[model samples]
Target: MKRGWWLALVTTLSSLVVSNGAAADQSITALAPFEVFADGFRDLRGIAIDASGNVFVADREAGTVTRIAPNRTRAVVASGLQHPVGLAFDFAGRLLIAEEKANRVVRVEANGGRTPIILNVTRPRWHAVHENGTVFVSTQRLTRDTDRDGDDDRDSDDESDGAEIILALTPSGQLRLFADGFKGLQGLALNHTGRCDLQDPDSERRERRHARCGRTDEPVQEARGARTRQAGGSLPHG
Candidate 1:
């Protein structure tokens, strides 16, 4: 039996809607509770709203992508996914999905088709978009394996050794690391100024790791790498 671990903490950005006739630019306010969308979602993780206010959600346990219209009608748009965790958009009006288990990012077009954008990503937990047509993806270190007692230890850290990282992918498919040293990188976002703002629920684990190694020199707060937001740290926009 394979045990799975899911982060219970929900992170979100509230947005103020401004109408522009056919489309609108939503301004994020704060994190709000997830309101039930017709009561059919099981463990909904990542959400993305399109220009028309159509809500798209990636259901991890259901392995499906759902579309919730303004009328509160729920429909499964795609299925058979490998635990897709993050969802975003590209410059070409394509839906980008971060498939966590497959370590790949894929694109779903408007015609109900899918294409691979980037593959072999390192434990991508979530992703966000930038105005410059660049896509940033976050990687968390999660693995599933059977333990000695025949029980799956989903949170076991016996095999993890690398630090978490956020990678930026250019339009040409070139990948670059934007940030590093995150113990358990989860949700990632890029603000209007191209600054990457992210949150980690398991930051306490990193502190414990530092303390175990007798690293008293480390700051008791969040890691230094997380505090700095670099402009143009990502690839140039196409």
Candidate 2:
């Protein structure tokens, strides 16, 4: 039997309507204790909130995507996914998802349809959608099957060897290698100044890997990379 890892989120109900002035602070009610949403799910990972405040969560272990409404009702938007990890809202208000084990990014429509936006990505753990509908994603190194039994190696200690990268997905269905030379790239984000500020904890002898990713690329933080530069050095021109 395959032993499955699980992560379940306990939903908290907060008091929504508060009055004006200091009376609001004094009369505010406390939040309810966290409880399982519609019972339970497994291995939750990336989550995002839509304009209407609906929370979309990716269940990594269960291969499902769920929507949590303002009224705390739960709905399964997508199921039978490929180890989904990241969730975001595109410029057009569509849902975007990243799958680590599946090595792809997909767009989910309101009618529950899915289209592959980016493919052949190796370990795409997290992603973000820009205003122009571009997608920036962080990926890790592909695991090795040392024994050649069709399963990747399970040993995770010191796994930051040549396995960090960022990818760009254009609006017109173009995929490009945006950035590389990271050790343990994980999550991604974009700043107002539009610089690629990487969050690499495995930076052998450096603080972080801040690449000057083009407007197409963004920033992300996760695993560690080997020593590439000295502290406070200029961002690598990768």
Candidate 3:
């Protein structure tokens, strides 16, 4: 159970993605990628660093969560999770994982114990933990089949809440749809001023098309179009 992983984007605090010598600035020195711990990772997905400088890796295929210590030693903190992807340390240093196949997010303990934080999530992939303990989760596809006719032909799901949705989960366990109508939402990041942005792959030519949301009950559009106004930037406070 080796725990090494690619450590480019998760070096210290921020990650910079450069292309074709785009970052030729003298102040920016390109660093070589290094493995932190032992090798042999079956499927490494999301990576996170804790407050204590400990590195955690999520193996979606192996169904395990591994922690690489500051001294380079590795240990399995949690296991048996289903397709754990995005990982974030909460305010208290607890590891929260977005379990995609499980359709929920779970808090992993030091002794391999797990506490289900949210449920009924559809393909929850990446997530962000707000300073106030509010979790913002991005889902690929949600199935809200009202008619139960074996097909999710709901007008609401097809219109606004279609194949993608951003969900907000409160510390008190309340869940709400933050925003919707996205195609390639992958991860999430929040700036110091408390604005939400998505890590999308489909925004290549549309680079500036980041879905930024406010902390209020109103939704913020990614400047998408008319449907964006209806898909306000905030969720109703629980």
Worst 10 residues of 3 by lDDT: 223-232
Choose 2 or 3, whichever is better by TM-score.
Answer: 3
Report the C-alpha lDDT of model 3 over 1-238, residue by residue, as the tens digit.
1112212336332333222233343344548653224345666677788767787888777878788887878888777777778888777878888877766677765544566676656656777777687778777444444112212323222323345667776555456667665666656665454556665555442211222332434453231110111112321111
True-vs-predicted CA distance for residue 196, candidate 2, Å: 4.3
Better of 2 and 3 by lDDT: 3
**Candidate 1 residue-wise lDDT, 77-152, digit = tens:** 7787777788887767678887666566777756666666666555566787666666777764322221122123
Q: Report, for all candidates in order, the number of backbone clashes.
A: 2, 7, 7
Off by over 4 Å in 1: 1-38, 140-161, 204-238
Looking at model 2, residue 58 earns an lDDT score of 78
Q: What lDDT does the true structure give each of the candidates?
A: 0.55, 0.56, 0.58
Error of 2 at 175 (Å): 1.8
Of the candidates numbered 1 and 3, which has the greater lDDT value?
Answer: 3
Runs in model 2 lying further than 4 Å from the true structure: 1-39, 141-161, 204-238
TM-score, per-candidate, Cα-based: 0.63, 0.63, 0.66
